[model samples]
Target: MKKYISLFLLSSILVITSCDERFEELNTDPNRPGGSVFDPNLLLPTATFQHGDLITGYSGPILFQSMWIQALASTSTGGANYYSNADKYVASPSTPNYIEGNWNVGFSLSSRLNQMQILAQQRGLNNLNAVGQIMKVSALSVVADTYGDIPYSEALQAQQGISQPKYDSQADVYNKMLSDLEAALNSLSASGDQLRNDVMYRGDITKWRKFGYSLMLKLGLRLTKVNASGAQSWVQKAVAGGVFTSADDDALVPSDEANGYSNSSANALNVPDDIYEVRWSKLMIDYLKNTNDPRLRIVAEVPPAGLAANRNGLVVGNNDPAVQIGLPNGFDLRGGSFDISNHPNFPGATGSGGDVAIIGAYSRPTAIYRRRNAPVFLLTYAEVQLLLADAAVRGFVPGSAADFYRQGVLGAFTSMAKFGGETVSASAATAYINANPLNVSSANASLKMINEQIWATTSLFANFLEAWNNWKRTGFPELTPVNFPGNFSSGQIPRRQPYPAGESSTNGESLRAAVTRMGGDNWITRTWWDGGN
Candidate 1:
């Protein structure tokens, strides 16, 4: 009994001695620096790369927007068809998956950016904070554009105990984005240590400023229909702040061959069998061919053995500018008269030797675009130039709209060559611009011509969402609506995607209110900036 009591006393003493007040300090992980506080540099690349991927990735642009804009078409039938309903203006269950994916990506990336901003402010890392702010706005802008109202002010505030954030109006979101961009620009400086992981611009503070201002230009133009005075003010402000002046200042994210990090369009269009299913749409091909645009050869290619024998080392039909054929939208294999043998350029002998009218015979994306490492263009100088041309037409900026228009066309051609792995000579670009000068006789005609050129230029980058947005704003290109039976929106093209269905359960009240405010969460509901055109 005495021995047991002595042992118990010794154990109690040991426990008491081990109980230090700084227990957490003693156990602190040496591996983790500044626990729970991440370096802003580390977070910058993640936010930029993920934001770029989300915007240019499969779910956001390639799958829906590209098809809607008639840049690409679905050739598969039944279960294998991914964009059948989307191409035909019919709703499908998979759409919400895409919506949710985009929503999650935007918010998830912004959450990290929010953390980085807070940490940077604490550390007096002003430039890093500015980068984070710009990225946050960029990520959220996609969300707001995609779904009208979204949680903005109250978003990324879970640590403050606000679990369910309220959705801000689209107008409010845009206003906030513009204000945030301006704040970021003001905070940025070349004096400080730049972000080490700045993947887009590689720590070039001037380019970052230009990127922010370019975003301002885009957002400002977005308000043209709804707020002309506001648009003019912001456009002028952006130009004064120094927008992208050349292709060298284009904001592009270099992609690797990895699955998630690879180019989104290439991922969708470069597969062995899947590549055959996707081809240039009739809208894009016909427009390029009719206009005698030099970009057509760079953007598209004929299938193997689809044309006559090789001539002068050229791949015959594949390389010949005249032999390209685009498959019509809203058609399956049987629906489209895809019999290559019946094609006028078919070089097969009589009926016995012709190539089958299948996926291989149609014009597909160019080889350069299918490469694994093709860079993803986030925003380009050409787009800014085109916007400037529009602003000039509105008399919002001082410049010849025709000259800006020509510059925009040239910029687009130059930028596209980087992706197509083709060399478009300056002379060729100049010749094309000379041939297709902007018609400036009437304001209406000039605006229409500029917007039409915007459409064509945007298609080269597969910038479908922006193209659709511009089409909605200016009503140019006059795309024929798909009239498939049982189609949603009465055979009209979708104006917006429906909110993710999961939002109904997780954020029901907020989601319901947003839907009510937007006048219903269907595809045809015009967003705040849409102006109901």
Candidate 2:
């Protein structure tokens, strides 16, 4: 009886101890995963997709940069007057919200990447950590470029009690980004732990390295105007470290429409105003037409004759190069003197009566761009080659400028197929390159040609923000600014977008200090790298 009681007491003590030890764990929800068990790889795709989507979405790039650069022109007729913020440099009701778009999106992406990197570090995942670093640079670079100074060195440190982080000057931002990018690129290794759920490269370390270097080269080029020596150093390092050599190396994130991760630019363009009122700018089309560029047919389409047909996204338009006409920028549909119909050499309306389409004859972006699942291009071999061409022309490197130019032009043509569009034939691309050779006469002439091609290629790729940035740097393709009434930039092309309105209340001191250094907070004030100082 004594032995039996002892055995029962010991068993009861064990049961109570076990229950006490696992009390919290047993009550915890299995569906809610803790950070310890979560995979960092999942953050890569989300950051990558959001980066592309936010930049290309309706708010900033679509409503502002795209038209500001005259790549796409809109009439802003009827209820689509928000487009005037882009088309005429006139503030719209949504301008306040739109100006903050990139700032907000960039920081959001940075925060996710920061968490991913911290987690990666804790696990000793070098490749994941390096990738996170590279992506962070890419995201924050856009922010610094858009706004003169932004939260950089101290950004995304909320857990460490850094809610109102100081804004780093654009120059400091660029310097740090270049250094960090270089370090991250060197850290990536093939023998490292296997990376999973990679949406861009499928864990290919080589391609990621190339992407990093390519991005570095772009950043280097951006500093050419303000810091030429620094630009040369970074460009040299990028080339030596190995940049993208082919379209296969392009960093394109795939969109899954069925899974609700559709392309945002395409979605924005499908809106009634965007589909009907928006058309390819005359400057863009005329350049292609005059050069007999093969992309004219692949990118621009004239809608079928009628208003209904033009508005119908399903109706395929005439893609014949000869018939495509581009709409002149800074024009409107309102019947006052500024009406597009009143412009010289206006293509006549396509239909009569209720079916009449005033802008039907003008070219719209082709169906390929409107596809919801089209891949978003982050960086491409074509852009890298074009930048190399410029570098070579400026004696920043030893390579032949002409050869790089040829590669760039051909790569640009070949890259079009990635849009899910009609592929430009290799023979045709070769023919175009052969016929139009790079003019290696004077350094200035070569520089102009190279940067102009950059503008054209970037514009076609729907990277209008980059296109604008390059234009600001090189002053190439010499665009004429619209002097519409109540313009924001005093009849000049805007150099930088104003900061988000919330910055005043949240980080007012930092914001005011940065603004003081920048001269003003409005659009015309240049960034540090843009010759502000």
The TM-scores of all predictions, comma-separated, are: 0.87, 0.93
lDDT (Cα, 0-100) at 362 in candidate 2? 92
Give the per-residue lDDT of model 2 (tens digit) for 247-304.
Answer: 9998887777765677788898787667887789999999888878999999999998
Candidate maximizing lDDT: 2
Misplaced by over 4 Å in model 1 are 1-31, 35-38, 91-93, 258-260, 305-317, 334-360
lDDT of 2: 0.83
> How far does residue 10 in candidate 1 sit from its true spot (Å)?
50
Q: Can you tell me which runs of candidate 2 are displaced by over 4 Å?
A: 1-32, 77-80
Q: Give the count of colliding residue pairs in each prediction.
A: 0, 0
Model 2 TM-score relative to the real fold: 0.93
**Structure candidate 2, residue pairs in collision:** none
**Model 1 lDDT per residue over 1-533, tens place:** 11111222233322322222322342355643442443546656556666766766566676677767787765544345656555676555565566677787788778768766766886789998898888788778877887789999898787577778899999999998899899999989999866776667878999999999999998888898889999899999999999999999998867645334566667766654456566777788888888788888887877654223211112323646798777667655443453333545433321124634344355677777666567777789998898899999899999999888888889998898767477678998888889889998999998998888887777677667777778888888878876665576777888887888888888899988898988998878899998545
Residue pairs with backbone overlap in model 1:
none
In order, what lDDT does every prediction score?
0.73, 0.83
